[model samples]
Target chain A: MALSTSSAITLNINGEKHTLPVDHRTTLLDALREHLDLTGTKKGCDQGQCGACTVLIDGRRAVSCLQLAIASEGRVITTIEGVADGERLHPVQQAFLDLDGYQCGYCTPGQICSAIAMIEEHAAGWPSAATADVRPEAGAPPLTADEIRERMSGNLCRCGAYVSIVQAVAQAAEAEAAQTPTTARQFSGPSGPGDLAHPAGTTDAEMTA
Target chain B: MREFGYQRVFDVPGAVARLGADPDARYLGGGTNLVDLMKAGVERPALLIDVRELPLDGIETTDDGGLRIGATVTNSDLAAHPEVRRRYPALAQAVLAGASGQLRNMATVGGNLLQRTRCGYFADLAKPCNKRVPGSGCPAIEGEHHNHAILGASEHCVAIHPSDMGVALAAFDAVISYETADGPGELPLAEFYLPVGDTPHLETALPSGALITGVTLPPTPVAAVSRYRKVRERASYAFAIGSIAAALDVQDGVVREVRLALGAVASRPWRAQEAERVLTGGPASADAFAAAADAELAAAKTLPHNGYKVTLMRNLVVAMLTELTEEAAR
Candidate 1:
């Protein structure tokens, strides 16, 4: 049988399931913006180079412009529109708002989403290019301005609002750390083992087949 | 982007068979590079075999005490792996030095190794690029080519492979494992990337319709003290203008063993065997490091704009090796 070019796939976005028929060529960014009217996820370069289309997929930051709509099924996706807890703004967003983290605000959504995940990744002890020591025992590096700049390098602001962006991210990271001392826990992979696409008990033969 | 079919498989052998049955199919890992190219009209596959769900996202130890990383392992996970950071610090640092946090979260190790060059001519359909078009001629050789290759490049193409992970892998003597219709096969990382003689379009030695399963790093004691240094236009989120991945083992003021690899200097991650040959069993001095670097660049040929790369590469090799030597001493 010839394969169909379109399929009715279900995408779990923002803790909600949306079933729709999408063309195979449609990227997840397009599906969210054009198909589902979730335009909070902006498209800057329409490529992976710019992180304007950044979203949290399986609790990690990823550019949606490069993800195929059909291939992203069965994954939990969170966009900027769903970032708030009903009326409460996320600490990252609140910091950005209070600090004027953006000028034009075109890249703010992406920056916000990216910062949320970036803080988690930093707290998890994942080293960045700015990291001096990569030894696992060295523990998580301090969340300084340089660290925030390196971790959030993907998002570009035409307004050159990087100064305030860095400040906002640093404040947010500090707030999060203060809330939970365990936030800077030693880097274990992702919290839940089941979050990864690969399940445990996979055979070696299959892994290296 | 053009329309294509998507097939996600949980098994490696079945995925290989599905791709083998279709001549124009391409296995999709993270889609960071492939999808971007498809949108740019560079790659137009009829079918995209989604291998992300395959049981190949593992990082395990081999019986020989080496590290084996599954092909579908994301760059973020790979860099964060405790074993990778402690045993092969250069590999972890290389991945972190690559693209941004979002791209790293989406890019797979296999896809990162197979990404095409970032030459403007290759992506611009209006321009002539030998790597994109077999005989279109390399415009980057004359046009804006400050980042072009200086070593192991022909008139056909001057584009450099823009992979930081591949550079570290080359230094550690990585071996690629793939599954084909015929069965399983292994190719050393040295032989994986084909030389850009006349066919810059033909990149890898992997057989047509074969699926890369994983990459294995042979146990190299020197890698434990290795480092990856990249010099780019910016402090972050930029491709390397010149980079080095060097691992050193120094004992009693003598170089016991060393591994050197250069990135953004050639069509592939250049394993600097000449430098290794010169440094092994030699006095562990900064001058010795410079001499080994010079020996490695003896065969380097440069274009008008890319002439700076030769000197840049020499400095990188020296800086990386000298730093690794000191770190090893510490």
Candidate 2:
């Protein structure tokens, strides 16, 4: 009912700089959805109890609903919309699509963003409650099913899509592991039976050569 | 939410000055709890001084083998720090046991200590909560109070402090460092919180415009044998119904020393000083643990719906002490 003072601030969202005027009481979630039209991040509960408004600030996952827009100045903001490489979907997104990780899809955006950061955190050897050894031997901690479930406990699925969601994360982790060789043997030689085996379209002479 | 002035301070002195100028203004940390309260209409600050970027985000060890944690250090960073996990495992476990991963990444140590009670009546603006409005009356004393306090509660209010970090700090005898308009000072974590007497609104002993710089945790001999056990309704991402943070020291199968603190069952993190007294120089066994728990919880008064917390707190204390003794054996 009363006129509120607004402040002009610049936000770096998804690699682009946008300067806009936002109310002093506006949250990062409201600023992204209402002002900037980045509606990919959904708002289930305005309170910090729900994880539907999760986003990445400086590559770390945080609930945007509780973060004031003015307080988030100078930090790189990454929402669900900025997760992909242009047209190509991120590996986690692709896995979610292939594994049917959503039903009504209301919490999909937050889940995807959280999963991306979750994988990176695990790769950096961050320990979760399920981890028995808080300080494990060097390198990435194994993405066990319990560990994934515990790490992803913040994001909730009302449609009971948790099974599919965990499956998607596990598959994406496998894909990422295969892409990046962690051990020396993977780069030295092919130890598996499928290595050096010719494809169906390859000729015998081509295979031999 | 109402419109308020926002000011970002880059130094401690500037923050203290801005807050001192306006009595109605409040310091903004990570905004995890303050913003939520603002949205619920429970907190209406005329001005918010942002102190998240005041260059207090480091965790370093003191010369005496203790840890000096900056105020703005994120919960996730503090829990994931190698020294914290190694030296004060109970503190790290307590931080991780609270909230979710997303919330932890945004919450700060200073804000966590200063967090208000999570009672439903306190958050409901329409309800008659004395904590929100003085002389309004505490509806939780007679209403749905399954999570209300069971210890150190006066007739005015019975809300519990909803912070796992405070419990761990109480067990470690941590000290809080702060800067005021006059000068900088420190207080023991136990003495920082004021008892909920007639005025539940005045939660802390902090003066107006006092900026919390950091907390210093003194090194303890039972660091490796300490543990935090939380009993909640759900498995993860839920508030504790009752919790315990304990550090046990055993010698020759006898209890040499012990420190205990309880959470979610008291107005503040109830330091079990009586329990520690009972455990010292006693045999390290289940019977001794039960006796200690009984001594600590002898003064607890429970509401209708929160009577279960007494049993829950006693069991948690015994279980945690037993686990620590077993760990020491190994």
Candidate 3:
């Protein structure tokens, strides 16, 4: 028998606070789908092999199934359900639809989440091995097919939507770079699954600062 | 699914305290390797010590003109560091050739170095593997051994270390630093991994209750000319068939100095001492390179199903050294 928890962890999910008594070993994917009923993030492989359980923590995409629920306490988590603004889908989602990036919708949520994070990472001047030049000051190189493949290598799709997924990410990168102002772009800390949280004993205001 | 324990420490002292409290504790960093193994039922530790919150996440230049990469530094951050790519191209290349962007973002330096072997028999508990269970006979000896080691093989174990970063670090004379119950110290890369002589289960030479703190690589002029060549079944996300990390200094077509190491063909990162000896006083040519490869691989003992790895290692050595030679000439 699994032990029940009396202490509840408060998580900021999609801009709302959720307090639930979750098992220590229960994964974030289980917490979201089974506990909170947020089921947009699919679980293809309980292990980290498949990218179907992808979600954005803060702003970076991470494999939710591999992460423990308690490990993500007090962090901002954005699921596929909260990726859009009201009725409009995220830019990556729109790009995926425009490019037919998915044959089966089972992997679409993961693809969109991963693509969104991929573009944000590239725009921040992070370089993958396939990035012809890894210099950060090189400044917005064209997202070629090889570069896209290398950056998106972690997120696998059984449907082989790689070509279209690459296209969607490229389109999203172009659109996102154009929409955001220069001064507003910077990579904050712990954007992925179980990223570093503010140290204990620090007040909420101090953590926000 | 089985239930286990999880504990997250806030600082280095806190982590050490947690480990000190428990004798049989597993350190969790990034959860890229440890968590996977636990889920697969290969590893079941009663206590898990989270070291991600420790103050070891940094990549900086040492006072001695070397690089000190902290244990918690992410693989992606280490590879993407400007000084790393500029000075040690092979290290960057090897890291990039690993799993993928998302994995690199999570895998840490210490975790990658301490990862266990990836033999089919080792992962499958049903199969007999001395590495997984000491004194158990190796089924891979007569079974399907396509991905097993060819160079270093005992009568008991044939698994290969599945880490590209460790191979590259071996080539550059990197040193591993760890803290034990008696305090902290460092050891050369070559002396870190123990051979699978009588006990295939014991992989590293670290004493009980020791934690890897950081890896330091001394500055070398030959670092700027280094390169990593990996020949895998696929273009990405696969283990190497036979990988070579070569660093050479060639001036006017003559070899000045060279360091070479092999992967996927040995129990540990096989440093090509004989190959380095053969290249010391000669011009960079196919003949000299082939002779060097032959000298290093001459003592290789292939298993029943892995004789092809001999040819793979020979070809990789020649091709990698030749490529480094050409680059140095330019």
Better of 1 and 3 by DockQ: 1
- TM-score per prediction, in order, is 0.95, 0.93, 0.91
- CAPRI grade of model 1: medium
**lDDT of candidate 3 over B1-330, digit per residue (tens):** 456567777766567666777775688887777777777778876677877777898888999899999999988778767678778878888888887666776789999989988888887878778888888889888887887887767888888888999889999999999887677878898998998887889989887777889999999779788888788887777788888889999888788899998888878888899899989979799999999999998998887777888888899888888888877767
lDDT of 1 by residue, B1-330 (tens): 678888889998899889888898899999999999999999989899999998888899899999999999999999988788889999999999999999999899989989999999999999998888899898887788999898999989989999999999999999999999899999999999999999999999999988899999998888989999999999999999999998999999899999999999999999999999999999999899889988999999988887888888888887887787788778
Q: After superposition, how far is residue B136 of candidate 3 from its true place, in Å?
A: 1.6
DockQ of 1: 0.49
Give candidate 1's iRMS in Å, 1 decimal. Answer: 2.4
- Ordering by DockQ: 1, 2, 3
Top candidate by TM-score? 1
B128 Cα displacement, candidate 2 (Å): 1.0
Please give the TM-score for the first chain of candidate 2. 0.82
DockQ of each: 0.49, 0.32, 0.23
List per-candidate RMSD values in Å.
Answer: 6.6, 7.5, 7.3
Q: Flag clash pairs in model 2.
A: none
Q: Chain B TM per candidate, please? A: 0.98, 0.99, 0.97
Candidate 2, B1-330: lDDT as tens digits: 868988889999999988998887899988889999999889889899999888998999899999999999988888777777778888878888889889888889999999999999999988998888999999998997999999989888999999998999999999999999999999899999999999998899887779999999998868767888788888888888888899898888899989899999888888999999999999999998999899988998988899998889889989999988988888
